[model samples]
Target: MVDTPAPGTVRPGGRTARVRETVLRTAGDLLAQGGFEALDLAEIARRAGVGKTTVYRRWGTPGTLAADLLDDMATQSVPRADTGSIEEDLRANAHLVVKTLTEPRQGRLFKALIAASLCDEQAAEALHRFYATRIEEWAGCVTDAVQRGELPDGTDAQRVIAAVSAPLYYTLLNTGDPLTEADADRAAKAALAAARAGTWSTAAPRGRPTPNCDN
Candidate 1:
C-alpha cells in the first residue's frame, strides 16, 4: 500500500509539491489582483488546474491557506546580509524591504495578506511569525556589531532590527508615500544611531537572549 503524508506537510519535491506550488501561485495571483476576499478555493483549484476537492482537503479555510502561504514565504525569503558592518547590513535590510514593498506584485500581495491578517486569527499569527523570522535573522547583524564594539554592549538586537524596518512599514501602511533609496538609507541610519545611543539596551550583559520588545 502507498503511504500518504499528513495534510500541509512539506515535501522535498514530487507531484504533491507541484500541486501545492501551482495552487499557491494561483492563490497569490488572485490575492494580488483582488485582495483577501478573492481567495476562493474552487477558483484557486480551477486556475491551478488541480481538483477542487484536493485544494479543499489540503486547506479548508481561506485564513489557513493564507497562513500557509505566509509560512512558505518566510521559508523562502533571503537570509540576512552579513556585511561585517552594522550600518551596511541594516541598510541592505531596509533596501530589501523597500524593494519588496515597491515591487508591483509583491506589494499588492502583502496588502492582501495584511487585510487577511486583520480579520483572521490564523493569518495574523502567521504574519507575526513571518516578521519574527525576518527580525530574528537580521538581529544577528546587531549582535555581531555589538561583539565588534561598533554598537554598545547589551543592545537589544531584535529591537534594533525591528526599528530598522518599522519606519519603512509605516510609510507603506500609513503615509502611502513612495519608498526611495533615500528612505531606506534614513531608516538604517536612524536605527543604527539608536543602537549606538543605547536606545534598545537591556541593561544587562549579552549572555542571555534579550527580552522580546513586544512587551
Candidate 2:
C-alpha cells in the first residue's frame, strides 16, 4: 500500500507565496491592459481568485497599492550592465530607463504616480526611495570604473547616475519626444565626457587620509 501524507502542513508557506505572486501578477496585468484607473482592488481580487478583504487588508488604499506596486517593479528591475567602461554602462542604463518610461501602460502609470506624489507626501517619499535605489545601483557601476582607472579618481557616483537620466527625463516630459537609441547614446556620451573632464572629481575631499577603508 502506498503511504499518503496529510494535507495543509507540508507546504503552507509555499501556498501563501503562490497566492501573493498571483495577486502581483494580476495587478501587473491590469496595469498593462489599462492605465492606473483600471486597477481596481476588488476586481484584482476577483481576477486573482483571492478575497477583497485580503487585498484591502494587505494594501489599504489605492495610493498605497501603487506605491507597493512600484516597489515590486523595482525589485524586479534588471541589474546594471557591466561592460568594463562607464560609457557602456551609462548607455545601457539610459536605454533601459528610457524603455521603461516609454512603455505603453507603464508610461501612463508613471504619469499617474508623479501626479499622486505631488499631492501626497508619503507617495512622494516612496517614489523618491524607488529612484534612489535605482540610482545607487547604477552608480556602483560608475564607481567600479573609477576604481579601475577608466575614469578619474574620486568621481561622484551619484552625479554620474543622475547625469545619465536627467536629460532623458527632460526630453521625455518637456520636449514630448520619443527617446531613441541615438538620444540615449548622446546622453551617455555627454555624461561620460563631463565625468572624464573632472567635473565630478573636484568635489572629492581634499587631503583626506584613508581611515583604513577597504573594498
Candidate 3:
C-alpha cells in the first residue's frame, strides 16, 4: 500500500490556500530548474516565504515533497475536450499531452517528477494517482462515444483513453526524438482503431476466471 502525505500538505482555501500555491510554485520552479536532487526543504521555505519548520514538518523528506507537488498538479489539470467526435476528442487529448510534454517548463518538470518516481516510493504512488486523475478526466469522451453509437457498447472508457496516450508517453521517455503533432495524430488514430476493433471491449473467456496474484 502507498503512504499518504503528512498534515498541512495542501490546504483547500483561504490564506492557507495562498500559501500552498506559493509553496508549490516555488517547489515546481526549483524542480524544473534542477531536478529531484535540488529539492531542499529549507531553501523551498525561504524562496516561497513560508516557515522552514512548516515545510520540514509537513513534508519531512524530498520524496514526500515531490509527491505533494504531483498531487497539486493532478488537481490543476485542464478539463477534457468534448468535440462531438471520438476521433477529434482522442486527437485533442493526445495533442494536449504532447503540448504539456514539449513545453519548456512543464516538460522539464514532468521529466524531473518522472525521474523522482522511479526511485522514490512516495513519488511513485503520487505519480500513479496523478496519471489516474488525468486519464479519468479524458475517459468521458469514450463513454460519450459509446452512448452515441460511435463505439461498441460496454467499451472500457478508461482503457481506451489510456491507450491513446501510452505510445506518446513511451516516445517521450524512451526516445530522444522530439514529439510532434504527427506523433500525436498517429497515436490517437491507432488507439481509435484498436477500440473500434473490440480490443478493449472483449470480456474474459467463459469459465476463465482471472488469476489472483496478490496472495
Candidate 4:
C-alpha cells in the first residue's frame, strides 16, 4: 500500500509527484547502467536527494519500483506508425522494432528487464503486458489491411503482428546474430506472404484469395 499522511500530516502533491519522477528517473538510470542486481533503491533516493523513507513509502520494493517504471515506459512508448498501406505499415513496424533493439539505452534496458523477469513474477507479468500492448498496437496495421481489402475477412491481426517481430526478437536474444534491416525485410516479406496465403485466416485454412506480392 502507498503511504498515506496521518491527520495534520503534510500530504504529497505537486512537489511529491516531481520527487517521485526524479526517483524513478534515477532508478531507471541505475537500471540502465546495470541489470536488476545493480539496482539500489536507497542509492536512488540518495541520488534523487529525496528521503529514503519517502522512496520506500512510495514504492515498497525494487520489483514494485521496476513495475511502476515499466508502466510509465508503456505510457510513453512509441505509438504504432500508420503508413496507409499494409506493406508500408509492416515495413515501418519492422524498422521501429529494429530501431528500438539497436538503440543505445533501450536495447540494454530491455535486455536487463528480460533477464530480471526470469525470477520475478511481478516483473515478468509487467514485461508480458508491455509486449502485449506493443503487439496490439502493431496489430492495427493488419486490421487496417483487412478493412482495405488487402487481406480477406477474419484475419488474425495479433498473430500477424507477432510474426513480424517474433523472429527478430528470437535472433536478437537467442542467437549471436545482429538484428539488421535485412532480417526485418525477410520477416516482413515472409509474414506478408503467409498472410496472403491465408496461413493466419480464422476460418478453414484450405482456401482463400491469393495475395499478389509482386507489388
lDDT of each: 0.91, 0.78, 0.90, 0.81
Models, CA RMSD each: 5.9, 8.3, 5.9, 6.9
Please state the error at residue 51 of candidate 2 in Å: 0.9
Q: List the residue pairs that clash in candidate 3.
A: none
Summed over model 3, clashes come to: 0
In model 4, which residue pairs have backbone atoms overlapping below 3 Å?
A: none
In terms of lDDT, model 3 sits at: 0.90
Top candidate by lDDT: 1
My TM-score estimates for the predictions, one after another, are 0.90, 0.79, 0.89, 0.85
Pitting candidate 2 against candidate 3, the one with the higher lDDT is 3
Ranking by TM-score: 1, 3, 4, 2
lDDT of 3 by residue, 161-197 (tens): 9998899888888987899999999999999999887
lDDT at 196, model 2? 88
Model 1 gets an lDDT of 0.91
In model 1, the runs with Cα more than 4 Å from the true position are: 1-12, 204-215
Candidate 1: Cα lDDT at 143: 93
Query: Over the stretch 127-211, how does candidate 1's per-residue lDDT look in tens digits?
Result: 9999999999989999999899998888989999899889999999999999999999999999999888889886665567878
Model 3 error, position 17 (Å) = 1.5
Span of ten consecutive residues with least summed lDDT in model 2 = 4-13
Number of the predicted model whose TM-score against the real structure is largest: 1
The digit string of per-residue lDDT tens for model 2 on 1-215 reads 97753211122458676876787677767766675577788999999999999777766666666666667667778899999877789889989978888888677667666666776665577788888889988988888998898788889899988998899888877899887888888998899999888888955554777567575
